[model samples]
Target: MSARNPGTKLDLQWVSKVRVNTQAVLKRAQQIQGLKTPKKQWQAAWLLKAVTCIDLTTLAGDDTPSNVHRLCLKAVQPIRCDLLKSMDMHNKGVTTAAVCVYPARVPDAVKSLKAANSSLPVASVATGFPAGQTPLETRLQEVRLAVSDGAAEIDIVINRTLAITGQWEALYDEICQFRQACGDAHMKTILAIGELGTFTNVYKASLVAMMAGSDFIKTSTGKETVNATYPVAIVMVRAIRDYYLSTDTSTESLLWLALIKEELGDDWLHPHLFRLEILSSDSLQIYHGTSLSYVSH
Candidate 1:
């Protein structure tokens, strides 16, 4: 389920509104969570990704080198880490800058990061996490601990108690405080796609995250069985695309010195769609402006 494979490509299948309901969201959320103890490998991927980008690390404490654990320990030495380490970041790489984990494991993740490049981002979830049902002070402390432990990025789950209830202003305020707490580190707002449950709601969540002060907006926390599927990601990408198209700045700003090599080619449009977190080759292909060859994953 963790689409961290280099060959992963983006092929989002957008599902319009008129398709999701409160019951559907609640039922699906439960299903994804229950999948943590999957009985099959195929079902494992989606269920696994639903819980972690480093799916293989699920058995971090298991003495035996479980398949998923083996996949994760490779990250101990990124060059030798998971499938993402061997990727060609110079060309066809499809990984987020770093792996995300629980706050308690942030140190291990930090220690596992490329020591030479300490800048590699290590994201951690915070602020009451999935349910977002905790007090503000306690949530902030969780974020503080995560950062102090070396998390380079923070992905705080919004206060769904507020967001889902149409309390946009309250949601905005919480995100604002969370953003401020993040300080220098980048913040990725997790919408917990399971709760959103629909394209329209997903779109609204994306906008809310960005507008409220998210450096990047994410899908589910992976704590849920519903991972960052193509359809889920596309909703955010389109929102990002539409955002930049309506802004004063251009895509050139996201690039290095305006055209690191040649002109914009066919990508002259100013869009935030460029900032995506597609973890699989299948998803990556959807937006492949350039093709790449593979090596051993």
Candidate 2:
């Protein structure tokens, strides 16, 4: 999104000093969930914003070039042209934030995007996605390969074992290697908060990822048993804000727009600094519903 986070040396002191008041975090999350959502045109506008920040993803095992091509085309035109015309947003160049797929599917996504004459980015998941159990050298090479295949963004998973076992330095070192492997491509670090044990460890991992140069710190891999929960997201965004205040370097947030608005304010809600990874079908469904509501009213 913004400039790449150059990253800082491992601040063991800061990482160690972090703590989470579980009950307080739970209370804040409940309050946010109880808040009211936008209605009518305002609801449509929010949906539009979400569409632009979506990373349309297809990580299925049966993924093929044809389906990847289809995914790219949908990303290029996420909403119906007629509905956009009704909203007078047809010329706004609205589209999904990016299209994400596995490394083997990067080339397919790149080729399809080019054929469509669209500049949408192709993001690839590397570093033993869903599980960071791979050897160090192998994970690094996986990142390099994805970049070589034209992945504009690389989503790498952190080794949960390191975070759980209090290996902050090791976690930071591994992420730094991934940053180098990314070269010019943006790096989005997945904390996989689900397996990171407690809220405290999740906050620690988020800080370590930012300190190690993650342009964007993400919540889950969509494969985890607990993906992107409100409580976990609250911890991660706080880490993002804390990192910015200390380093003056902004890290993007992938939590919900409403949550970002409440936690980090409106500035962080833009697509450049915020993203939502969603399935193509789910995004399309939401888009369809929002557009119909806007057109009917």
Candidate 3:
């Protein structure tokens, strides 16, 4: 895992200058998705990796502790024991990257993981999740309460009003406050890209979130009509690559970039810097067997 992106000062000029070529993004995404995929054991191995990156989530109006516990159990053993054994991964201690739920359900997830003796982190959606129209003070308090409830990760919703209206500074400041409230817990800033209305806005929001010290810049909240898509992901990862590059200075930066470029192709695409919140298991299965294009991105 690389060091957490300690975000630099917000650069409005850079943010304003950011651009996304939609046609190019679409073409590259298609090319990546069209690549040939692995088969049999190879496919299984990739699916297992997909399982590990999942933020196994359940966010509903009627969620209960029993259901949360069941979700945690599934997170601990995402695949059946026999299936893992067949794949020769039964004793590998495989688990989803984390378990996500409402802020109020954090304790349930923590208790369940503890009872199961599993160390899976509990990720809570806070700051007026799904719809972030609450008062700023209330929203910030929500983050604090979730952290106090034992959430190791906070998935916060950015105020799309600010992004859509071109209020970049307000948006960056708001996210910075949310990041502060997260304290030691990692922050996954949800850009809610679908609602931002343009690829350029999506790209800009991704940069602002990273610049505000977000641990991971996620694509969507799964509440939008359009959730995660390859085109949007490409734009986001490119911004991540740009941010990684910007962190370096002249000669040393060039050396480090070359080293990472060779040693870890698309190294910024890992779970630490990026995450995709999918709506169904079917998409995960498709990503696993058909193409690493979607999975790798």
Candidate 4:
């Protein structure tokens, strides 16, 4: 696994066609066996980690993000600390995953695990998440505070009006400011695709975000109709694949220069760790939400 093994070549001849039929790509993934298991979870993790350049977090309900933040860390702690202990113990540089929080709970989320030595990535949403209508200034302030609170990742929504009206310039500037506010924090721009009302808009907005400097172009806040669908995700992933192809991979390039840092410790993500925060049953709930039956330890 040398970094310079001339990485696998990605053919981009069908980027648009792939984007057009991303639903099919997801269908192909679903056909794979045991996609719900820990071993299979790596696919989803890998997409976010490598291609989309983000750390995935699950936001299930209206529960305050701060509480969910603790809940998330605890949910996967077993799988992370115990399961991946071997890999992480060998190298402390890696981390657990994502904190996945609501905007209001970021401060406490950062404070909650300050003493731990693991990389418990803190993420928050602004720009009027869920509804996405707060003033831009407020969103910036939220970004400022979230960063100040030790948030490693920031997920923000696009302004629905500007998006529909095609105010991409304004939209781009907003994100640029957010990128500035985030400073070194990775930014995952959530399109809330369901609200975009069309796959076309979703595709376009995703491009706009990525072109403007979004570390990751995410599908949704997981609270709306289009939340985290395999189809929409593929669309963005496809677009990114296209964007990446035409662009140079030089070290000085914007896309090349920025790399998303792993915020989850190996043990912090799975099992066989010194402490336990997450359990299998609770994690089943994270992947399955209310659709499945799961019990917490």
Q: Name the best candidate (by lDDT).
A: 2
lDDT of 1 by residue, 171-276 (tens): 7667777877877666767788777656667776666566565666667655566655544544555555544343334221112112211222334221111223
lDDT of 4 at 2: 7
> Per-residue lDDT for 33-129 in model 2, tens only?
8778888998888888888988899989999999999999999999999999999999999999899999999999999999989989999999999
lDDT (Cα, tens digit) per residue for candidate 4, span 159-264: 7776677676677777777778887776767777778766656766766676666765656555665454444544554555545544545311111111111112
lDDT of 1: 0.49
lDDT measured at residue 177 in model 4 versus the true structure, 0 to 100:
78
Pairwise TM-score winner, candidates 1 and 2:
2
Q: 1-297 in candidate 3: lDDT tens per residue?
A: 233446779999999997889999898767656555556876666556656767788888888999999999998998999998987889999988788899989999999999999988899999999889999999999999999999998989999999999999999999999989998888888888889999999989888887888877777777778766767767776776677667662201122222223323644223443333433333310010001122222
Q: Estimate each model's TM-score.
A: 0.57, 0.92, 0.87, 0.62
Question: How well does candidate 4 match the true structure, expressed as C-alpha RMSD?
Answer: 11.4
Q: How many pairs collide in each candidate, listed in order?
A: 22, 0, 0, 28
Per-residue lDDT for 60 in model 2? Answer: 90
Clashing pairs in 2: none
Worst 10 residues of 4 by lDDT: 284-293
